[model samples]
Target: MTAGLLAPPTLIRTTRGRAVVLGLAAVTMAVEMASLVVGRSIHIGSQPLSASVLPGLVLLAALGAPSVGRAGDRDRLVPFWIAMAAGLLLGVALLSRTGDLADLLGLVVAAANEEIVYRFAVPVVLATALMVLRVPTRAARVAGYVAAGAWWVLLPGHQAQTDGAVAMVTYASFAVISTVVVARSRALIPMSIAHCVLNVITIAHLRGDITSGGRGALSACLLFLLVGTFAWPGDRPGRRAAATDDGDQDLVTDTVIDLRDGQRPSVHRGEDLTWVDEPSEDDQPEPVGAPGDRRSANHGPPRH
Candidate 1:
């Protein structure tokens, strides 16, 4: 598997994808720093860093959720949702030491900002560009993951202490999981909730006392789960469904509706389109060609 993955096309595409996503993430980071500076001056707060950073994270997630979610929709949403709910309950009980609920308040802002910045905006933009540039999926996935983690590390005090470090790790871990889950599920809602739940847990933990060793173990477990989930056969979402002569597993991508919630599906470049061409009043039917037309014969039979 390793040798095959290192073939020429794969190597070149992976390298290119890494570079593209890295470059985009670097630029986005610069913009975020500038925005933080601007936002700080215009605001009043003792914890200005938190104030500045949380909103940035939220906006990034919001911007990217649709596309990322679409990519992840095929996965088992049940496990993802269960993980979130359980994580949330544990987080509230163990992490939120202040018990004031306000300590968790910063979390709301953080979730919004981080999801957009790390999960949605950065991944979608970078991944799309890399894929367009013919970057290999493996490389694109790695680059996007690293870029998101880098964004977390660069946060104001993300690296300053053991606690901050722990929080950053779990928080970033959440993003990583959400990305995979989102791509696998090919639907955004569950992953978005998962992302939010992860943040809420981190915030709660910040207020409580969790041993470093325990944190490390938990991180390891989550990371393991992420890898395991992605490795499962056809259980994940991707640039397209399983490729075959028949294309039996193909999904209609052009206009995926968010059936999980009432929200309309956001469009992405390469999703299945069979779902979109359904007979809606707004759709314009293709013209039937002349009797001798080869085009009609080649248009092929409509997929079920």
Candidate 2:
């Protein structure tokens, strides 16, 4: 309603791609939100249904949005490490409160659902709308990140009251960090895993698993950050990455999925059809009769 009513007539008529993207964005949001109810009956045998994955699956079936919230191999590790740091702060903030198993489960479900809402749906729709209104792609995306984080902090049933309003600033900071990572990677897995790990860490403290209490949990979180930061594979395969002088860290998403076309083109390096106009030296097949060719044709002795 906000988009259609207020959209400039000039833009509405002048721009067609924006309209298509906007329509796609709307459908993506609607499908994800509606699936929250319709997906209740979605079951996969004995294991509990991961409602978090349902919206993504529905997008796949209805819209053919294969890349939505899905990670690519080249997605960077700095953002992921940042996500874990944010989750660590969140777990530490929750230490003062009393929580049980039910709370732990509740946190997990909330993390999943809220990520879809704040990170997945909100960014998609908002960015498209902003773009339709003449905002540049990068600025609109930044605004979307801010909007998602704001809602994450302000939403009543979500992260707002998680700490009894004690660390509201911490919650706000966490929201910002979470949204930025999600937007940058265009994948929910990093934030999702970090958040779930945080849930377990919090519950472990509450359940006496961490014998030294918050201190032990803090140690665990720190240790995780250390190992994951050093061990994380941030670079694309067949590439080596060091922090460059120009800050060339691959921070943002590589491909954009348009629901109108529904073509999730594989943009993997060296894999996609459009990866090269002509094969590189490494990609060139060996010449059969060339001296240096590894698979040169066997000599015909009868020719002598």
Q: Highest TM-score: which candidate?
A: 2
Tens-digit per-residue lDDT, 91-110, candidate 2: 54554364333444455555
Candidate 2 local distance difference test against the native:
0.47
TM-score of each: 0.46, 0.46
Q: Every model's Cα RMSD, please?
A: 14.4, 15.8
| Alpha carbon deviation, residue 303, candidate 2 (Å) | 63
**lDDT over C-alpha atoms for residue 282 of model 1:** 58
Supply the TM-score for candidate 2: 0.46
Q: Identify the runs in model 2 with alpha carbons over 4 angstroms from their true place.
A: 1-57, 60-110, 159-166, 206-304
What range of 10 consecutive residues in model 2 has the weakest lDDT sum?
Answer: 246-255
